[model samples]
Target: MHTKKVIIVAQLFISGMMALFMSGVMSVIHMGFTAQWFAQWGPNFLTAWPIAFVASMVVGPIGFAMARIVLRVEDAV
Candidate 1:
């Protein structure tokens, strides 16, 4: 939890889970879950996780700002 807000926590969870599952499926699709599946997936997941986490951190606030303006929503606690 640390000092993370609700928004940040939600963003992390959503982005992380999405990336994990998507990468898993995509890796399997590319390699058919063969003997090399984890071997391949490890590298791919390692590459994707950081990018996804950083992207989520960067994009979440921007998207939230846009939504607030567009929908005239009050900032939530």
Candidate 2:
């Protein structure tokens, strides 16, 4: 198993990237590539990042556990 510090850092990076891309994509889909669309994405990302981080922290372990089960990777191994 990975260390808690490593998992937190990974989650921070993962959540930030996910929030950035998702906010941008959703903005584009909703408003197209206008000046306003570009303007909104930054704020959206800022708002989303924290929520994303918390959600990822909560869900990450469960998701990893499910993946390990599916892949038959033992935690002890």
Candidate 3:
């Protein structure tokens, strides 16, 4: 029942935050928290954000459907 605009806005915010956190975590895991981490993370996050945005748009509906099915099954138990 959510409107398309609301869904898109939610996806934008969620993907932005997710990309920010995951990019930092993965970069640090790969290179540690070096002084160069900021420089490295900048481009890395930039690359990831768009991909994350598009991917979320693609998978969001499927994920919602799966969650609904799982929750329904759980409630039936």
Best by TM-score: 2
Model 2 lDDT per residue over 1-77, tens place: 78899999999999999999999999999999999998899999999999999999999989999999999998884
| Candidate 3 clash pair list | none
Pairwise lDDT winner, candidates 1 and 3? 3
Consecutive 10-residue window with the lowest summed lDDT within model 1: 1-10
Give TM-scores for every candidate, taking all chains together and pairing residue i with residue i.
0.66, 0.94, 0.88
| Candidate 1 TM-score over all chains jointly | 0.66
- The positional error of residue 63 in candidate 2, measured at the CA in angstroms, is 0.6
Q: Point out the worst 10-residue segment of candidate 3 by lDDT.
A: 68-77
**TM-score-better candidate, 1 vs 2:** 2
Tens-digit per-residue lDDT, 1-77, candidate 3: 77799999999999999999999999999999998987899899889999999999999978877998987744332
**Which pairs of residues collide in candidate 2?**
none
Models, CA RMSD each: 3.3, 1.1, 3.9
Number of the top-ranking candidate, with lDDT as the measure: 2
- TM-score, candidate 3, is 0.88
Rank by TM-score, highest first. 2, 3, 1
TM-score: the better of candidates 2 and 3: 2
